[model samples]
Target: MSKALGYKSFGGSDVQEFFSRPDLTPSPVEVLVQVAAAGVNPADHKLRSGEAPDLNGHLPFPQVLGLEAAGTVLAVGAEVTGLAVGDRVTGFALTGAGTYAETTLLLGAATARIPDALPETWAATIPVAGTTALDVLDQLDLPAGSSVLVNGIGGGVGIAVAQIARDRGLVVTGTAGTAKRDLVTSTGASFVDYTGGDVVERLRALAPEGFDAAVDTVGGPSLHEIAGLAKVLVSVGDQSVTELGGATVERRVDRSGLERVAELMVTGRLDPHITATYPLAQADEALALVESKHATGKVVIDLRL
Candidate 1:
């Protein structure tokens, strides 16, 4: 049996429970993995709380709660040719059969073998936060020396974006809580403390001519406040961006993209930061930190711990 952390019904943390179940079977385009580590995100709690019905509406009850993981492949489906048993890889976990467990299913096309130098904990973050950063930047396609504003630039995806923007030679500026001032500025990006006085005036003073583009991780009012600061706008998750003549980030999940991101990490061009980790027994704690939206960097569950 595989031990897992999951929710029996859509609600609050009270719905989460630990249970044992049969090992998940891979589909024709899937791979079975013995999870060594899993990445935590705000989406996990959102899905568990029934906030994302569009994505979780079809899922069954007692669904496992994780989107990305890294581990050794235990088995591969008949149609899965790129991976073999015992391969160390990372990718998106199959819906319902999540990575927050002893065993879970990863889609073959989205999975990529990790380099020997990359730790499983870091690789586990590539499938989601890492790639999301890449996609948002690629969608914007800003040229070097161009200025860009990263609204809400303290979370996992936000930090990744700032680092990559710096590498690409784009001028980066971001707004975040005072506690994250060091973390945001460490990437060579200018940091704007959202809690200190008027944010709009502060941003205007930094880039009076306005930014070439703005990539928003915080939606709703935060996004609205910064939308006009840049000529181009792109949001990571907010579809409402389209109404403002901006496009939401387009995510492309494939083996090649995963390999490219893994290479960046191997070469030290990208770092997940991964400020916190927890054991499977403390899965809820790991997720709670991420859900709080105040985590400095990535939060991961280390099964090996």
Candidate 2:
């Protein structure tokens, strides 16, 4: 029996149990993949904590929690075309049906062909983060070369957003921990440390006029100050970026930006940035690391191990 990390109870518990189950038959419109790496998202924790909406029905006993993975096509159903066996693939946004497993199934929903130049880890990286970043940038309506402030630069989405915005020729400034400050700077953007308090005061000191756009990956009351300083504000988490009052605000969700992300990954500029890896069996540790909020970049569960 193939093993998967599943949620046995709600309320902030990330514990998953291995259980035997019948194999899933891939439908004609679906493809079966042997998961290579799974992306750990903040939503995974929110759902477990009973904060986000429980998708569809109540949790099935031993519920699986991940929403995205990059893997190879192991089997294909009749209704599927263009994708076939031996094809290396990455999953799309939401439509989450237990991707944190040795084997997972995906519909044609938002699956994209990964570029040859990009590694599987990178191919897996952009689907969700890239889309969210670009979407928020679009909402900002900022002209090219405008200044941008990216808070929470250490996480997967923040890093991806910074790179994408920089590619658009915008001046990007990011706030992150000292360890991640360099990574954000290496992407050809300015790095600032807000790991301390009074981020607004420091940002004001750096750019007294404020930025054209502000993307807050870590949402909280800090948005109030970010909104005050920026023309538009974007939040990628489930929480509100709306504290900005009259300023533009956006909350990231599934099915909103993956297609654009797919194109960028396939033909445009996106590179691999897998900072750390963990085996599927050690997913608990992976979640714990992310929960610590000290991870400088994407923490992927390497299912291949």
Candidate 3:
């Protein structure tokens, strides 16, 4: 049996628990992985809280709770190619076969081999946060030296956006809570404290000409407040940004995207900045930190911890 963390039904964090299940078998387009590390993101808690409708149409009692993982390939399906047993890889889990387990299934098309220099914990964060950052920036396609505002620039995706924007020669000004001020500024972004009153007033001081583009990682009123600051606006946290004339992020979850991120990491241009790692048995605690909105950067569950 393989150990895993999941919920029997949709609810709150109270519903999460550890359980055991038979090891998974890879489908024709899938590979079986022995998970070494898993990433914890807001999406995990949101799904468990029933905020998002079931994507697979039905919830298998004890639905797994993670989306991305990094580990070793234990086996590959007969039709799988480019991966072999004992290869190190990172990937998105197959629907219903989440990464929060000792063994899980990864779609072969979405999986990429990890560079020997990248640690599993950092690689685990690449599939979701790294790709989202790359896709959003590509969607914006701003010119070099463009002034961009990163609304809510403290989380995993936001941090990646800041670093990549800097590398791409964009002038970045980010709004984050005071707690994350140092982190946001370390990326060379001008930091604005969102908790402070009159955010627009502060933003105007940072960019008198106004921003050329904006990426919203914090939604609701926060997104609304900053929606007009830029000509090109994209939201990663909410789809409602579309109603305000902005579009949601363009997501590309494939081996090519993952490999690109790995290259960026190898070149020292991108850092996952994993702030905390817990053992698989302590996944709930790791998730609680992310769900609370207090995590500094990325939180990961390392099986070896």
User: By descending lDDT, how would the candidates be arranged?
Assistant: 1, 3, 2
Candidate lDDT (C-alpha), each: 0.91, 0.71, 0.91
- Please list all clashing residue pairs in model 3, or write none if there are none: none
Going through the candidates in the order shown, the clash numbers are: 0, 1, 0
Model 1 lDDT per residue over 1-305, tens place: 99999998999888999999887788889999999999998778888999888888788887999999999999999999789999999999866778899889999999999999999999999998999999889888889999999998999999999998998999999999998998998899999999999899999999999999999998888888888899999999888888888889899988887898898899988999999999999999998888887888899999999
Listed per candidate, the RMSD to the true structure in angstroms reads 0.9, 2.9, 1.0
Candidate 3 TM-score, C-alpha based: 0.98
Question: Which residue segments of model 2 deviate by more than 4 Å?
Answer: 54-59, 77-81, 93-96, 246-268
Per-residue CA lDDT of model 2 for 1-305, tens digit only, reads 66887666666653556554557678777788887888877767766665665562464666676777788888888877677798787875233356678887877545655655656666566556666677777777677889989878778888888877877888988888878867887888787777677877888988999888788888776555577777766777624555454333353443336556766665756544677788988887777777778877787888878
State residue 235's C-alpha deviation in candidate 1, in Å.
0.7
Compute the lDDT of residue 108 as modeled in candidate 3: 93
